[model samples]
Target: MAAGTPRVFISHLSGVAVFDPNGDQVGRVRDVVVMLRTGSRPPRVLGLVVEVVSRRRIFVPMTRVTSLESGQVITTGVVNLRRFEQRAAETLVLGELLDRRVRLIDIPGEEQGQAPGQGDGEEVTVLDVSMVQLPARRDWEIDKVFVRRGRQGRGGPLRRRGETLTVDWSAVMGFSVVEHEQGAESLLATFEQLRPADLANVLHHLSAKRRAEVAAALDDDRLADVLEELPEDDQVEIFGKLAEERAADVLEAMDPDDAADLLSELPESDKERLLALMQPHDAEPLRRLLSYEERTAGGLMTTDPIVLRPDATVADALARVRKEDLSPALAAQVYVCRPPEETPTGKYLGLVHFQRLLRDPPFTLVGSIVDTDLRPLPPDTPLPAVTSYLATYNMVAAPVVDESGALLGAVTVDDVLDHLLPDDWRESAHREPAQVPVPVPVPVPVPVRGEGANGH
Candidate 1:
């Protein structure tokens, strides 16, 4: 058959002799197997089984089969039937390991529903019985074998489709008439589902190139999440493997605070190079963030705050709020500022609550409606004080100002939390207990008894 041509049912000519390339009779055809193709017109022959005199069965592909003549089969290569026999007897391969009925044991905490006798114990309580079978070549190795009802389309008389058990190659302990599928590919698939923190942990266990391969496979959003969780040093190191444009794309997709943090750790020259490669708009925010101290409110805050002109109507403010890509932390309140000044000094009058903005009349001026009682903090204000101020006012965020009272940025509650409770918060602090004053013990000068008293 042609390389890609589809084939139908293949006849298993039983008792037909199998011969080596030298024409010596070796074995007899035992079985012919067909692997069903989902979209193809006809199923194709996966391989052939030959039963040898040693009571061992070996699998040979139809591709290696040359011809079928009168009571004889011809093959291309002189495969040591012994080697094939040894391999078949030693390990569980696809054909023999499947279709045998086995019990399914659910791992604790992994069960979705409460089945009888299912708990956090290792007791091999039979949850369900299923027939184990080999998977197609394209299936993941860990999932090489599947479990299903032995009889197809039969009702109440036997097993139901719902009761069938599926076993992963990794879950099986031993193989008797069964074999486990490869686990490497399945592991990769499972790795893909892990959260960014878990994925970063796995990445720490892999080599740099493997890390790059796994990272390259992730979607932009997922990749950005993982990048944000990774150590700053690791971020720079892994980013080195990606193309400049690809790296720029990922950085652009990352949160402004996270992207700024990563860039801050890079050498100045590298930072400039990466920023230059990024989209102008994305790079602009990152540049602004980079200019601030890492622990400052401006550094921790997101630059995507919603701002409306003081002279604009509440309707216009509401419209702007609905249109901008504001973070949830900053979405509750919108700042009212003047148009971009020549020097861009913070000329904002106050902020308006989103609820108030929505409720006010359309013609109400934003400045007239804004809450002037808003609490503002300087960018240089300590994080503890910033957090305290927000807590005291019960504000989602407080506007950050420079020495000139020009609105530089707004610090959200989330940023304050991040600054106060870092990932390695404990590790960053001294481990020793704080010193406490101990009472000084008074020492009594013990007089030499005999010398102090007059000699007797």
Candidate 2:
């Protein structure tokens, strides 16, 4: 530990209230984002996931944090309202680091965290971690780990048998990528709090064997969510490894458009086999989607969109719009239809933007406030037409209606962007896995839990 370097344990920041420079409350810290580096180098702290008043989690870069004392965080007052989206190289310290089992490199004549009977590579369960700003630099890095000795139990580390200790970050091993026989259980448990896209990013960088193990361990809904965010080749590879019945279940959990997109990549026999395993009702939408050209509105549109009958109240529409799983684009508006609310819904009456829903009384009928001025796109609309339609109207999502004026589905901006971007875009932007150096014993002072060098 450096003599004058300021440091604070991450556990202290969990759920701490954050305020602006003027002292007005902004949000609460949810997690610290960091990028785990190669070898013994400490992971660089990136930012904080702050949950704002509306419960929308946003990122506050560490550079923006002016103070971290008194059990509260103070930011620069300027905060971005955009939701935090974890990237490929980033890791959430609180979500994916704590409770992880790592090892202490055996240093002759020097020890602290190791149990009495344990030899070299003593196992420890991470409890907390501390970050320190580099001397004369604004960047912060994880420098110390607070861990408990012994195997973890269902409740937690066995209280009677485990001894907690803190050690320098370099004294431990297993934080970086390594080719070994590690199971995915601990990794999966630590990743439970990550969003699907974030989890997909983690999986994208993992070894194929490890990726397969983790995919097999994930539940149908979770695997489906992760699959939707993965690259086409990865999706096919993972899907091919699942049991037929499990594959069918995962397909059912995926959005119809995504399921169709994935299925289009598989051989006809394989696609037919999986579709045959699925429920007829679930397979129908995929079948409809598969019938269209890959770049057409029908192909790009999600079969499921927010749909409400004309007579439905604004309250009911708002309730549907508030679902957490719906993307911002899909949640931007609700479609008003006659009946058979699911797409292809009965005669499309019009559409109601979320803003108009908010402006109207709760008891007001959605039909009354619906916007009929904007014309809907046909399923056969080309990709260029869909792009122009959305861009010209400044819309995040556009409606797709059949010739009979039935609400078919909706094409969201994300889907449009996906089609417009290069096929390898997702894979091209990520950084390669960091190199891991062999662990060597090093003599270093170990700090006990709850005490940082800065004495915070």
Candidate 3:
């Protein structure tokens, strides 16, 4: 390690705020870019992949970084806005290396021989990497590895006997070599804190094969959440790879509207097969949704909106609104209905905005505070009308009812926007630039004053 250089664990830097030299917030760190070297040499740290406020990830070379302290990064303020694209030789530390199985050699200088203690040294799984900047240079390289000792089990490592330790980077092996069937347990652990949308973005940038591996590793609910945020093509591809029973379970875990949308993209035979695998009660709402036109309220609305009876108290409504899994739009208000709180609920009475609940006493009945004048949307309402209704009424979600006046679902603003945007909107929003500059191999030169990052 370089004298006076502070070693920082790569995992600790994930999602750390990046700022300009003048202290303006730039973005959050998404991943570290590193180039693996041949033989036993440590991989050189190339740059950071930062997701800015626009959600577009851009590359910021190590040279641009002025300080990494107090859990924040200070940069020289000259960041390129072009989207990041991975080079053939580069690897993402968080995406590719974490949780990977490797052997920790007993001797520091020995790179390839079996150790005198246990065969193949002691097997370990990588948990994180630590890097240090080279002395008098702007370059950085990984120097330490944090690893856990254990063979991987079906659920994960045998936690009771697993031991974790930090070792010199050169003491471990297998990072540079590609494993065709790498398990996603460790990688998923590194990303467990990410929101579904951010996790989906990370998955989007991985190789298709690795993406499938990660998707399969995620539990049903987590996979369902990520699938909803993923691009349609990616969604279809990953969903297609899961075993039929697991696929049906994941679909059932998803929001009814999202599950319906995914099913609509499949062949009739495949779609029906998965649907049949689901419980009859779970498949019923999806069947109803499929009967509606693609761009209509019935198709876009989620059947699981917060529904409450008129007799329910404001306290009851507030408790329902506090559910952690409810989206902001769906949690914005509570639909007041007669009997049967589930969708296809009896008589759509009215809605009580969350704001109204806040203003009333806990004992106040929702029936007394419900706003009936705003009117409910018919299931057949067109997409444009739904969008306009949300905007004009300043509503985050609007109730959708049938001719018989039963509440079927609620259309949230996000669902409306999803339909309004162009089919390729997601692709265009995060598209890579036409060209990318490949990093030069190590023995890196110090940056000259006023020199641009990655040669601009």
Candidate 4:
């Protein structure tokens, strides 16, 4: 680390507020741009990719950055409003570097051959990289590499590991012009371990082309999860890029309510085409959801909750919940129904909250202990009514029924919240002064200065 240089992990820069010299908020930092160099000579930071109030991405050259510190980045107020087009040689720290597996130049005997590797080096996953502004040149460069020594587990949570190595940038290898060309290749496996929301956050920071590339690399189920977390506009864009069959498969993997919401964002013709390509069983629920006004309970409920017979035992109910790869909210409760089968289920009986199932003996019949006190929501119930119903019942999920009392589906809390939020909530959430954005200007270089923020 250079003396008098302010050091920060690249992640700490993500979403931090960027202010002009006049103390006007320019935008929030979306990505850090760095040009790769030979021999791990701490790639020079090029500039920042900033999204302004209007959602336009502009570039603020490194030379314009007066300070780079904790919660804010102070720039010289000379932003180039001409949109940022990532050059072929530049690497986006958040978009392309984080989570990438790289080779650590192993010092022969010091490193046991435990880490996964190729012929020349030991493999380590880049958790983050620290960048610093050298006082003299006043330029930023990657100074330290934070890495987990192993080929990260793919497709699930990573196993806890040995101490993370905070190595000088030179001790790290693998970042190259070749990596920038290959795209998220070395990072996809690591991405598999991220929660859908986390992956969506990362995707939101990439260029459209790079975002599509990463989205294409994800498995249908993973892509579905990620898509559900994204804004509707983003959802539509990525879904449009998929082959119709693959898009249908991705929709099938999504919660029916989420899939319906996403499909509703499309032009009716495109929506219908995708629906036609889906398996009939998968498409039916979404079709029914689409038939309703988006603010209605019918439109917000997923048709895939674990459904059990009135005669089913706790053990049977437990088995169903375990068998399905349902989201937490969906798995929070089970519906007891009179049925020839689950979907288009016969009659809506009472419900059994998961906690109740856990409380009773395994052999106890779920129907015998059902909670019939909380009434099922009508398919036509409006969004406000649905929100109130959920809040009053203190329920994470509520069942929906048609006029005939046949079970339709169940609405989860998250779905209702999405509806209740402001139309631009997704965008606003990213830049709001009171939300994720730091309300205080941080000491980036000389001192902090901004509205709604205290200077250091």
Number of the top-ranking candidate, with TM-score as the measure: 3
Query: Lowest summed-lDDT stretch of 10 residues in model 4?
Result: 447-456
lDDT of each: 0.56, 0.79, 0.83, 0.75
Residue-by-residue lDDT tens digits, candidate 2, 1-456: 223456798867766889887787887887788888887788888778776665556677776677888899887676655546677677777656765678877432444565543336767778889998777665678999987777543322333457777888887888764424444554576557778876886677555766787898889999999999998888988988888999999999999999999999999999999999999999999999999999999999998999999889999999999998888999999999988988889999889999998999999999889899999999999999999999999999999999999999999999999989888766643332222221212213322211211100
- lDDT value for candidate 1? 0.56
Whole-model lDDT, model 2: 0.79
Model 1, residue pairs in steric clash: 97-178, 98-133, 99-132, 141-182, 346-406, 346-407
- Residue 230 in candidate 4 has what lDDT? 80
In angstroms, give how far residue 193 of model 2 lies from its true place.
3.2
Query: Tens digits of per-residue lDDT for model 1 on 214-333?
Result: 677676777888887666556878888788888888999998878888888778998899999998978988898888777777777666666777788877776776764456777788
TM-score of every candidate relative to the true structure: 0.49, 0.62, 0.86, 0.65
Q: Per model, state how many residue pairs clash.
A: 6, 0, 0, 1
Least accurate 10 contiguous residues by lDDT in model 3: 436-445
Query: Which segments of candidate 2 are over 4 A away from where they belong?
Result: 3-182, 431-456
Query: Model 2 TM-score?
Result: 0.62
Between prediction 1 and prediction 4, the one with superior TM-score is 4
Instruction: Please give the ranking of all candidate structures by lDDT, highest first, separated by commas.
Output: 3, 2, 4, 1
Model 4, 1-456: lDDT tens digits are 234865788776767889877788888887788888886478988778877665656667777777776588887665555445677777888777876767766433344553433224666777788888777675778888888765443432344564477877887677762443333543565445567876786676576777887888888888988898887777888888889989999999998888988888888898999999999988998898899888888888888878888889999988877864677898889998888546668888889988999999999988899888888999899998998998898999999998888888889998888978887777554434232332234424322211111111
lDDT of 1 at 136: 35
Best by lDDT: 3
In model 4, where do residues sit more than 4 Å from their true spots? 2-32, 35-43, 46-91, 94-182, 431-433, 436-456
